[model samples]
Target chain A: MGPDSSQDAQTISQVGEFGLINRVTSGRAQSPGTLLGPGDDAAVLAAPDGRVVATTDVLVEQVHFRFDWSTPHQVGRKAVAVNLSDIAAMGAVPTGLLVGLGCSPDLPTTVVDELAAGMWEEAQRVGISVVGGDMVSATSLTISVTALGDLQGREPVTRSGARPGDVVAVAGRLGWSAAGLAVLGRGFRSPVAVVGAHRVPEPPYEAGPQAAVAGATSMVDTSDGLLADLGHIAAASGVAVDVRTELVEVPQRLTEVASALGADARHWVLTGGEDQALVATFPQGRPLPEGWRPIGAVVEGEGVTVDGDAYAGPSGWEHWR
Target chain B: MGPDSSQDAQTISQVGEFGLINRVTSGRAQSPGTLLGPGDDAAVLAAPDGRVVATTDVLVEQVHFRFDWSTPHQVGRKAVAVNLSDIAAMGAVPTGLLVGLGCSPDLPTTVVDELAAGMWEEAQRVGISVVGGDMVSATSLTISVTALGDLQGREPVTRSGARPGDVVAVAGRLGWSAAGLAVLGRGFRSPVAVVGAHRVPEPPYEAGPQAAVAGATSMVDTSDGLLADLGHIAAASGVAVDVRTELVEVPQRLTEVASALGADARHWVLTGGEDQALVATFPQGRPLPEGWRPIGAVVEGEGVTVDGDAYAGPSGWEHWR
Candidate 1:
């Protein structure tokens, strides 16, 4: 078995918290940049690029996922995924992750191990290592992940760079996670592929850098709805956004899921979050990349609209109840 | 008045969650390297060192703090302090923070604002900004914080660099937080200073980089008991540690509290956690800088000891009951 394959739910639960942590850190290759891996106050990484891009996210059980709903691996993957998305949004490649976990002792050691395995799997996907973390006992499980990214000699993309006439585009699918969420919330399961989308978000991890290289401005990861995310760009750049739905193409799988679940694919596209798709504004006449699509354009109004009409679905995911 | 001064604890409750967050993000002088401050999918920051140092910590009411014992501001400070300590442990300077909050609506808005105010106040101490965060509703109050640091052309200090003859030293106070915790748990308030220590730990923040500059091989923050943390170093660095009790400097304040409470101050010193002090190893003949005290030396052994003997004390803080 490979580094990731030496994991299982049974072994995960039986391993003590520290034991589980040791397993996660064992046999992993550290970046020549890493001075420390785990089991310390903090892990150190080399920053030859002269600066670092940083972000964090916290996942709470029941709020983000339920033990009954998500396996330990799934939870771990989600924890790392959301934080990695933050780094990707800044057009930086992630280097290391520090995780702080609060869990109930009654939670089997295997469950926590599975979570670590999932995190490791995701960390491998991004070519980064899980460096350091903290573990504490709590009433429920909470995973707080912080990701550090290496910019590698590039300026970070902020939300304030979209010019009024810049063309707006996206490099990944929309509403897929939301469609999966709707299906799960309705006591239904999507097809294996769609269910997998809900279990683990397969973001276009390389697309953010490609867009950056293509001279994109004001890029963001769509963890919220597309309109809500674009609204951020609109507010930051002081430009109105007019998305041409006629040019928007829905993933056929998502449409089938929406159809089976009796939901509008557009609603999911408009409001679903956690897809972590990269959206950016490019100067007019910019050549589009192969995977990117021109779904919208910058305009002279205040809010974002679809095909020139205001979208009235839910604005985005609100953390507070 | 300053951005934080105008808002009193009373009107703060009325300010509501979003309102309080808006206050936290209101006009301020952002640090030089912050590309984006807040209010986006994720905040963008310039990693001047080319690599971001990151760590996460979660604070839960009742488990980490009691509302009765700790004011909201203190809670906020501790939340930030612990994570900042992690960054410091990495021998890096902090640059930004992401905060995710979950609390009951019945919780006062003033409390939330005070939390932010405290977070901001502490953030400035490390030259980092409150770059981004999340807010949500939940059964209890939870503050999950991720801190990002910049490594300023130096390698991060880790737990595995000690050799057989390195001098082990520490660069801050030890055991005050645990002593304060004992006071609170026993329904006795310590004197002003000791009681205050429980609310907000004063870690030797600068000592991190100073130690790094002084050519320390390995370093860790004593948030866990000294032995527990050093045991980690010993295991990773493949060395044994012998801490000298005669050389141990017990804080006089702790002695008084231990006497009044009929507890052992030595226990607090030996096993108490949350000191956030910098403990590091230096090669023989390499002198420790000011603010650091030589405490012990690394040897060829398996575990940690005090006064050349195995210590049978409280061991350390245990999260799960």
Candidate 2:
């Protein structure tokens, strides 16, 4: 056995990346779905459905999460959630994940375990499993997760599929995470709705396949706020989308954050991001599925419009800046 | 078109990881292999072959490469090299790489660009492509890369297949990179061969497939040295491996360092790691191809020995520590 072989009390940094990696992967029981997992050139996953949907997201410490504001658990959940939302955007059911982690050597070993736990928990929420991952030492903590999804024989509903006269609908909460950001930023506490919204976003993971089955012409994940994401759809599909602000049922929690921050609730609703909601365009004659609220319509022009005009305050969230 | 558009002149510490990342990945082109690529819920890639080989490695600033010691190009090449070596270890041809970079925002954009150029240069060397990557701000520069490869319809040659009668062979340079390390460590300008080895490792990309085609039963990449990697094969295959030390050749460049450091050149040859060479087991009667040199033979025992004993020195390299 390697010298630092104790199951406990040995920090990963002390052993280094390869040593810690060997310890983490040593003696793990293998599962059937894992044709070839970690320790190989690449993981060989059986995508029974021909096409596989893949997405990668990188989360850096401080920039992506503040230790002062978010628990390690929250950071891990957010990392996984953001990547899973990408899979949902593809209208695919996530199947496995390949994580590349670089953490400061001084970070507690329990932090890695906690992050993995958060990833597993959220992955389980979508009935997906975390197949394998790698850990390395760095000056800061980062989680780079690549989610693999199974399309299940369905054509992926891309953002470039919408056409004129399609009804635009959205599923899941919008602007909640951004509103929670206000509370976290202002050091506000005890608002269950606000705090809960920030810690773990409830992405409508199911709405994607539902829309796919419901014959959606185009779909996208509401990552960069509704307007910006819809604008992406409009640009990619070469059709304009007109959104009606009257249809936005702003949750009371967001309204309170708006009051507290002296900021517009519509700013969060229109431009704030990270809800991981699903938005799709359905043909006018087709009916929208349950939980999908009609908030807009695809039109002849190019670009996205709020109530038929370019009404914007703030834009959507960006990963880096 | 975001706030990070600010000329990328900020110091690493100023804007944090998020800002740095936005600056790094701002305008890189996305290849056709990418279905979703960077931003969305997840990315979708076309895996025409049913199986994919995956490997990840992390490089810390001071540990993997010192900002003061290594050029960003060297760091980038090393990052991609280690991952590519993993793919080669599994007898797979690397196709694409996904990078997760964390760096101090204050770091020069030219430095980061140099790193990317280095990655592209080495990637082209192996015929693999950089499909997608993520950048974020961090306390220092940390490079994480995940390589995807295809085995071209051949079964993966795992470490579990070395038999008693197999011959051990090596492909690519040994002790060169470690000699290069000694050059860097001693802060000496001499031993240019060693320094060159340190700056860039030349992994025999085709040697893995060649070994596979030549009927290799087991294989591994010599990142941690011939002994340590051979030990892996021995442990995994339940076979003993003995290296013929007399047959081992040490290049001329390692002599000066060995003398200055009061180290045995043999130790660097047998135990020195990070050359990214390939080692494999072939049938006793068969001859290896041009690039490979038969170093030893597999025996019935359950461990590795040099010249029929436990020849030990520094063992092998371990990251983080």
Candidate 3:
């Protein structure tokens, strides 16, 4: 019989807590930074920088993801990706992850196996490991990930460091996840590009430290769209941010998809979120880092604007708004 | 109006994500270890030991706590306490915490405020702070806390180090939370000592590192009762543990309460969990730590026995079994 078939035959309740923990942790290779891995009360990780960057993100089933739209593996990858992106946004390289999972007792064990596999996949991409985690029973599935990172002797780039003269640039894809969400909402999922992007974001993890090495003043991941995230930098730094739309690239693929859906591609490029792209501000006249392209500039004032004017659309996604 | 009256009038949805974040974080004093507090993508914390100890625990409403029995503030304190105790179990001092909260949108903002306050209260007790967190919407309340700690250049006291000639010792109250849970289960709340323990645990956080300094062979916290948690050490260290009933102290108050309820105080002390007490094994000839009392001995065997016999009760609590 296939692994899925056997796994489907068992539920989380049947496997039990210790049994489930063993299944997820056994035989997994740990990174060298993991001084002590799972099975203990806690995990120990090497922090050579003498400081650790920590961030957490919670993803709830139906609220943050839908099983009908994405598989359990995809959900797990996205959950870890979002938190790892937060670490990267701080100009740090991730070292380890701790997951807190709560799910229904009736859920199939296969879902958990797949979810763990996906989380490992994402952590492996950055050479980190899920050093420790907790699993418990709840009414619905909730994935909470805490990613610990090392600054590597570099100053952490925070949102408040963006100066008035700093030029803003971004690396990685934009508008793709948002476009995919629109396609899924319209009940047409044939465009695998956008759909897959929605399921699993391709965050430019390395660009964060790269930007920091190049003396970038501020950095943030594009989790709340370009304009909204930049607004955070502006507010924190006591400066205004203006995006030059002409300089922003709206990929032809997104344009085609938007045209077919009768939506604005530029809006997606400007306000789309969850792409996990890194946006940072650097000193003016300095050559931009590789893979980063200039898209805006910081000025004296407050809030974010597009082409010297406020973008005439919802800036980004907000919970309970 | 009183703070509760005003806060009760506002639901989480009305307060919104950003507003709720501001309410919890504003005016809070961050610890020196917290190089960067909440408000950014991630927080930076000092790991002076060059190795960071991390652990996570998830508490779900009804599954882990009941609103009818405990206040939100107490639940919050318990949640943070559990994670901190895990850090202590590693023979480390906690540095910071990251909370991931998932609750209903219609939940009162007062609950959130109280929860945050309680978390801060517990964190301050250890000279730490809630450095970072994530808030999301879910059907039921779920609190996930991840605690980071420093070993202070000491080797982590893991569970796999106990030897056959080691003496088992415990510091801090044992079975108090379990007694409180039993009282609560019986619908009596007057006995504040035990009932209050059920609400918030007082872990012997300092005893962990102290035990390590005194050359503890192995250490663990009594979150799963003395015998069950000792079972972990026994299995991990390839040894057997025998608890002498005469040596194990059953508090007089617990005995009185148990008699009134027709329960066994010794059983509670042996099998009741969630007291957050520190238990460790020391060399047979070495003196135990200041607060620790010797209660058992390790030998060549497997599993835990009480007074040279198997305890005739449920060993400990397990999530699904």
Candidate 4:
């Protein structure tokens, strides 16, 4: 998938920029929105609703991912997964992706192949395609993914749409990624699910659209802890969000791993982030969508609270910190 | 525009991530296409044509820019300018931008403000807004820009449509940016126009749509040298392109700068890249569009030649090299 290996293993500089691009992108399928894919000045995507939802994120080496801790494939998958989660948060169907990769010239060409393969694998799962992107030489490996999605004529479910009395629910596992991170940090290999979760999060892709269709008042993806991201909703919607700790069902795998490590699992559930779970507030009395579990409710006020009290222990992950 | 002066002129680590985001994006006006801007899960933009054109580029510190040579403002502007040039090459009007920034937490908070200001200033010039983006701490500064454009019901001008009987034309200044780079390398800054050209290129943006309307068969931006970029057109279209050196008019300022530096002005004109000038091929017997000057012609065969001969020079920039 990379280059002729009969000769000596080639570095990226030996392969050249265009050569690497040709190798990585060859024979990949295009999605429905891709009118014109790679190998052009720009890519064209169908935005049938006269609107396109877009988001971008940059993951730097050592900061977002470590080569010592992850394979290039996992880095690629995580980059795409987090971006797709953003689209899912908007209640839009992901259609296309543009990736910008910066890496050292001395790096092996096979690493880039693995990265592309991982990105392609995850993108295929969500019914989207990598439309276009750029690659350049840098001191470190950095990934920038720009995700485009189609609204399908639905209003974007913004974080500002929640109101008092709306029911807050979550879809997908929480704290697994955080638990995985802890496991990796401690150099423990037990609890495969937890470790795998940190490597490649399985976000509830369908839950986002399902919530929107079920009339979710507001929505968000848990990238910065459940409470912290919900705090954004509260701040934006101008209402108080009360999360019920007892009602929250902690995943058994996380609990087992937490106990093994002599830590509280509830802390992970409450403050751990990057699980990409869909947290949404639905209109009162509306039945929860498939795969959703009720965890909280909106109240009349500002800021987020737990069981009507400000229960906080390390609010969230702040990049500057 | 920045943090309070009373508190040790704090770094990003002291100001925090959210504090920086709020300071940079607060109270900025949004364009019509920006249905939702920053501070959301994702931003939504109007496409209206059922199609959207997208492109992305990543500019790494030291590799793409040097802090010693340019201000944060110039770096930000160049990042936006280069990406917008790709959109223009597609014969589409840019509608929005999504920026992803990675920087060391030790950087001063004011540097980020200047960078955002420069980005906002440039985006406003193109009649769009910075719709969405992500920022995170890294070892060094890196900027990734994703530009979205609307074709407005026009067929995209791709590089693969040139016919044998076509006249090649170019709009906007050539060699000035290259000359400016040479001037900067020599630590001389007398030629404001040339130096400024390198710092902030004023691409013939309007020429893209005008050429499309005038029935340009194929179009490309000269991010690579004219010969190298034209080689792409030739390869894509499977047609030979010939340049008439005498027909290529060199601007007086470029010639003066080249003479002063004891350099071949034609070398800069032929092989210098990053001009972002729109180079296009139109059917023979058709008058060139406004602001476009005739330079060469398309012929039956493959590859690019100058004055009926293959001119020899370093073709263009190679990122991996």
- Candidate 2 positional error at B246, Å: 2.4
Binned by DockQ into CAPRI classes (incorrect, acceptable, medium, high), candidate 2 is: acceptable
Candidate 3 has which clashing residue pairs, if any?
none
For model 2, the stretches where C-alpha displacement exceeds 4 angstroms are A1-10, A14-19, A22-31, A49-51, A256-263, B1-42, B256-262
Q: Score the docking of each candidate (DockQ).
A: 0.46, 0.43, 0.89, 0.87
Candidate 1 DockQ category? Answer: acceptable
Candidate 4 lDDT for residue A242:
99
* Cand 2, B chain, TM: 0.89
Model 3 CAPRI quality: high
lDDT of 1 by residue, A149-240 (tens): 76667777778788878888887778878887777788766576666677778778787777777888888888877888888889888888
Give me the displacement of residue B203 in model 4, in angstroms: 0.9
lDDT of 4 by residue, A99-158 (tens): 999999988988999999999999999988899999998887889999999888899999
Question: Which parts of model 1 are misplaced by more than 4 Å?
Answer: A1-16, A31-33, B1-20, B50-52
- 3 or 4, which is superior by lDDT? 3
Listed per prediction, chain B TM-scores read: 0.93, 0.89, 0.98, 0.96
Q: For model 4, name the residue pairs that clash.
A: none
- Model 1 Cα lDDT, one tens digit per residue, B227-255: 88888888889899999887789989899
Backbone Cα, N, C clashes tallied per candidate: 18, 28, 0, 0
Residue B158, model 2, lDDT = 85
lDDT of 2 at B77: 90
lDDT of each: 0.79, 0.77, 0.94, 0.90
Candidate 1 vs candidate 2, lDDT winner: 1
> B202 in model 4: Cα distance from truth in Å?
1.0
Instruction: Report residue B18 deviation for candidate 4 (angstroms).
Output: 1.2
Top model number, lDDT: 3
